[model samples]
Target: MNVKNIFAAVAILAATGSAFAQQTEFVAPDAAFQSRLTRAEVRQDLAQATAEGTTAQRQHDGQDTVYAAGGRSRQDVRAEAIRAASIRHYGDVNDTYFGG
Candidate 1:
């Protein structure tokens, strides 16, 4: 192949390899909620001591948000986390969805 074609093929191969290789190490985004400026480094600090959950992303306050929590079961932690996320998104537990 010509030099230009070789360069193009190398570029495509590098791009694809990088895309697939990136999946080898899963790194969730930082669980840093904008609120709670007074809290510790991350959301895990606020989770109940005995609870066990994972950092996850969700839509909150018109932006992407992340949180971490732990509980007796994964379901319990997920439910609580979602509720907290709702509060962050809507400003109140009872806020109507249409309002936002």
Candidate 2:
């Protein structure tokens, strides 16, 4: 082989060797997969649960108001119907979330 061809081969070999050197291995933390969640994470979960509950309550109230409204054609009666339902809804508000 010519000297130029030999030099090209050596360069290719050197580049290939660098690829192996650049590789890295990962290791788990000292506690591994048994790590406990942080306090902030727990707080986040609780907050999320609370928000979800509130959203569900709102959705329920919306559905009840819609039902009470009867139909969209009677828009004039809708507000009155919802207002009347609020009286009973006050009593229904008794739940764990409200400290009941």
Candidate 3:
């Protein structure tokens, strides 16, 4: 390699190494840290929040809180899915149906 190319490569590597070396380090909390609330008090507060329906609720994908009383049942949905799968085309339409 030429002197300029070797020097450019070294400079780029040095810059990257310096940038990585100057990253911030993680510092742990103090050993004397204490909680303001007791375990029993925290538990009671959590229970009260849960009873009042104020706790955070995580809904999974495709799930919602609303309920439909007259919705389709599990068996109905499964049968419909099976029927649809049985009639679904798994091959090319033009090649299978036409003389291609």
lDDT for each residue of candidate 3 in 6-65, tens digit (9 for 90 to 100): 999999999998877753876676867888999999999999999999999876777667
**Candidate 3: RMSD to truth:** 6.2
TM-scores across all candidates? 0.23, 0.27, 0.45
Q: Is candidate 2 or candidate 3 better by lDDT?
A: 3
Residues 21-97 of candidate 2 have per-residue lDDT tens digits of 85377665674566479989988987998988853444343334333434555666888788886654446566677
How much is 24 displaced in model 3, in angstroms?
8.9
Error of 1 at 21 (Å): 1.9
Give the least accurate 10-residue stretch of model 2, judged by summed lDDT.
Answer: 60-69
Where model 3 places Cα greater than 4 Å from the true spot, the runs are 22-25, 28-33, 61-100
Leading candidate by TM-score: 3
RMSD of each: 19.7, 20.4, 6.2
Could you say which candidate leads in lDDT? 3
Candidate 3, residue 90: lDDT: 50
Error of 2 at 52 (Å): 2.4
Clashing pairs in 2: none
